[model samples]
Target: MLEQGDQIGFLIVSGTFLTAMMGTFIVAMVVLHRQRQVQNRQKIDNLKSEYEKTLLNIENEIQQETLTQVGRELHDNIGQLLSLAKLNLNSAKPEKQAEGKEFINQIIKEVRALSKTLNLDWVEEISMDDFIRQQLHRIESTGYCQTLFDSDQSFNELSKDSKLVMIRVIQECLNNAIKHASPDQIQIKIYKEDSLRKIDIIDNGRGFDTSIQSRGSGMTNLKKRMETIGGSILLSSVPGKGTHITLSLAF
Candidate 1:
């Protein structure tokens, strides 16, 4: 019933309509892909910002804690020993003059030794386990969270700088939890696995949402600090379930 000219015209219109629809679909897909890419880039930028902020907090804490701890050692340990030696020398009996002279010599040697290592962290290596335990005990006495340290193999092989950075990172994290998270407990674990060093920090605190950007810059600064030292930090947390941070680096 249709004329040839009319049928031909209808076919052309149908083809044109279909082509436009396909073009629209392709264009829409390209726009969507671009939007997704932009969103992803923004997300990564935000994460970097957060990491930098946390690192700053860590650096500040390190300076403060290092100064405080060293001051303490210089005061409590070395100073007290020097005082005792002086007292003993003053009380030496006349009959024991030779022995007193020998004792005074020993005290001088000890005072010299302690003075040499007091402010200098380098020069020699120390047992990391013993060091960590001592640091934690010192922190715990400040009426902060109950701190615990556990390590399978004593991490005594790390360089002085590495140990200092790692300790500073841990120190910053603990301070954040106490000052911000308001956690009830804090735990530190250090271990060597397959030639790598791992430090796990767990806290039972008010908890936070990692999805939301941290209002306090402590988390961000800590992450950046680790990265600068050839280390990586993973922060995973859940609301009401506390927060956990795992740090890894080559020792």
Candidate 2:
């Protein structure tokens, strides 16, 4: 019953309806995909929490073992060696006093060397600068990144928890660069910006598109860690340009 023109119009309407239906399907798919991502992230967070607990337990065990070893070495080796050195000096003649002094100096040097490898208990005796430098030593040994840490006096003023979080976040950043970015240089700077404390972790390496997929599990874990302590993280990265991670923690 329709005219030729009306028939063509009907076809056009049908095509438009089909296109709308396809768009609606695509939108639904997108929504469902996002939901899946949310669920996956929740699972990852749970796993990360378990991982942290395990990490703490392992670290505690290693520290206990380290202290035991140090105690044994001090008692059986260094302590006895020092006593022997002192006895040698105490029983030495005037001509041999110089030799005893040389031996004492040698023993002192050995003690200083052992002091470098002494296990540190962060929960007890950790300074902010020491923590940062400790992380730097870890990243540098990997040979993939050379990281530098600079901080203002405000860094020392932060709470101990904040200091620990900052160190841990920077540690994660460096781990990502080594494990993923393959960066050659990474520089970390922490200072006060107004009422908040800021940490900047900059790396000169091949970056990636965060819009696509963030392949750095370390970064995602780092973000969750920061958020647990009432902090936030911002990442600026471009393909081949490099990565800059900025963390802001409240007082």
Candidate 3:
């Protein structure tokens, strides 16, 4: 009961409608994809900004700790040496003059070494292995407890930000062992496991029960810091045996 011309017109209209609907759907999909991309980029930018801020804070803490150490060394070690040197010079006998001169040279060497420590630019220049060794040496120099460090290989490819966080975490573990636990032995181990790098700090110290201990021991901060770097921390402890902390990072 329809005319040929009318049927043709209806077919053309149906095709146009279908084409428009497909175009609209495709356009909508493109817009949605673009929006998601923008959102993801913004999220990444925010995370990067946060990481930079955290790294800055860690650097500041390192500087502060370095200053404290320098002050203590000056007051305790260098001051006594200089005092002795002055006394030696004042009592300058002909035979002892050469000895005093030698002592002064030794003092100069120590001062130079301390100066190197004060220049924290080495933080950026040093590799992970060097950094960990430097920290362990500091503990060994203190003469209170023995420290052992073992690593599979140098991790030179880690980002400075990751290194900062890792160093802070290790420092915290060392401090906890030295201050609270009074450990006689502390050991640090670093190795690669599959796609991850692992750092373990083990101490034969008086460790408290992780379940009963308050969170103020900085375990929460450690966990959050590791999470920010897309890593995780595991703490294991026994009441009298020891404590072991493991940090795993996806490099």
Model 3, TM vs. native: 0.84
Candidate 3 lDDT, 6-54, residue by residue in tens: 9999999999999999999999999999999999999999988877787
Name the TM-score of candidate 2: 0.52
**1 or 2: which has the higher TM-score?**
1
Off by over 4 Å in 3: 124-127, 137-146, 154-159, 211-213, 228-230
In model 2, pairs of residues that clash are none
* Per-residue lDDT over 69-117 for candidate 2, one digit per residue giving the tens place of the 0 to 100 score: 6788788878877876776788748756666677788778877766754
Question: Which portions of model 1 miss their true places by more than 4 Å?
Answer: 1-118, 122-124, 192-195
Q: In candidate 3, which residue pairs get closer than 3 Å at backbone N, Cα or C atoms, i.e. clash?
A: none
The global C-alpha lDDT for each of the candidates, from Candidate 1 onward, is 0.72, 0.74, 0.85
Task: Tell me, by lDDT, which candidate is best.
Answer: 3
- Model 1 lDDT per residue over 124-218, tens place: 35566776676678668886768887888545676655566676777667767777677767888887778678888888887888888856776
lDDT of 2: 0.74
Candidate 3's error at 24, in angstroms?
A: 2.0
